[model samples]
Target: MPDEPAPITEHLGELRKRIFWILATLLVFSAIAFSFAEQIFLFLLEPVIAVMEDRGSKLQAISPTETFFTYLKAALLAGFMASLPVTFWHLWAFVSPGLYSQERRAVIPFVFASSLLFAGGAVFGYTQVFPLVFEFLSGFDTSGLIEQSWTMSLAFSTTARLFLAFGVAFELPVLIFFLAATGIVSARKLWSGTPYAVLGIFVTAAILTPPDFVSQVLLAIPMLVLYLLGVGVAWIFDPERRRERIQARDEESPGEPGSDSEDHSE
Candidate 1:
């Protein structure tokens, strides 16, 4: 009798199950977030409130529904952020079996690093960058001028954009590490582009930030630091060099594919 078909079919079944599980988890978290949406909004607005308080200014909502929508938006963001680990793990599990042992070893570290870096970026934007930016921008109000009233929707949108941008920027090292691991970039090449890269970081900062030097510098400096750190990470994961080292070691002793031989001598 022909043996049962290989486990390839089982992989598809497993993938579908994992996908369902991930969706269910996200839905559950999203509901929780939606229920406490107001608290989430308040937490999100803390930096804005702190900055305004420091400047002796106030933020206002123009529309009756503005605060509610802002809370809803914050809930969605919170849901996605909180569920990221579950999403990543599902994806990792789906692709894991197809990978060699070494590839499998790399997956967890990559996921953890990406999540941590993103969190670091969000914290930096909230705790440091936002305050400086608001302080600089508040100066534009001028004395005896019409009092500025900040709309809730506008405030939420701006803060969300900043949070997302910084979080994405923090993934630079993961991007570089993957590219280097795939042999698409080399440590030497990345090192050589340092000057241009630094210029590009600042230029990007200028484009994305509000029209003020303080915000621009705050974004650019951290971006440059992240890029430099990415280069170091890419160097460590440089696949071409890693392959060469492995090959040289292999040539030193004949061995079966993917297996090492035990040195035997009397």
Candidate 2:
């Protein structure tokens, strides 16, 4: 017999525990990040520094508190990135009770894939997208009348937002995999909705990226690619489709010669 369902109070208690674990993980990573906050802050400024170097410009801390706050913001961002694996694990653990035994075995793969994809997206933003954006903004200095000094707070905020946006966006394939695995959507259905997906991707890109056509296009292109990749992953791993294929194969095979006699005896 199957096990009884958990009580509502028990479920709530489990949820609270999972939430605490996630929070504790975040806090621990945040503390570690705070220790290296200056290094992380400088690393994040690489792209901006590259552009500014060419123009003989430098970033400034306009207020006395600006540098301190920038360091704190950078530490927070670093902590979140560092704690992603723990976060994903807690999330999966929270929902694993509802999954099949086979599905529960996917916990490690899911966590690893999520972390890798998020990191890839963040790196892509830092190396490819951020440079273009900075370069485009620098183009506005053609008149040579306005100075090009950036405040520490402004630089940190802008870079952190782009980093986070790209990282979240790149989890498209994982989201698709979960939706397909859970039977909430099919690969064919996702592919058929390409037009609408493209529209949504562009809109999301516009909202997440800086208000510039170049930045929007750059972000949208990768997102569109990732969406298509998601479609392929869903197609390859869809459990329903696999079951259908197996059933079709069984139906096509010849039955045993004495199958009728066996059925009659039974």
- Per-model C-alpha RMSD: 5.9, 2.5
TM-score of each: 0.78, 0.92
lDDT of 1 at 204: 83
Measure candidate 2: CA RMSD. 2.5
- lDDT of model 1 at position 170: 84
Candidate 1 segments exceeding 4 Å error: 1-27, 54-57, 90-100, 206-208, 246-266
**Candidate 1, 102-217: lDDT as tens digits:** 76777778778878888888888988788676666666867756665667678778788778778877878887877786667898899999999999888887777666788778
Error of 2 at 241 (Å): 1.2
Least well predicted 10-residue stretch by lDDT in candidate 2: 1-10
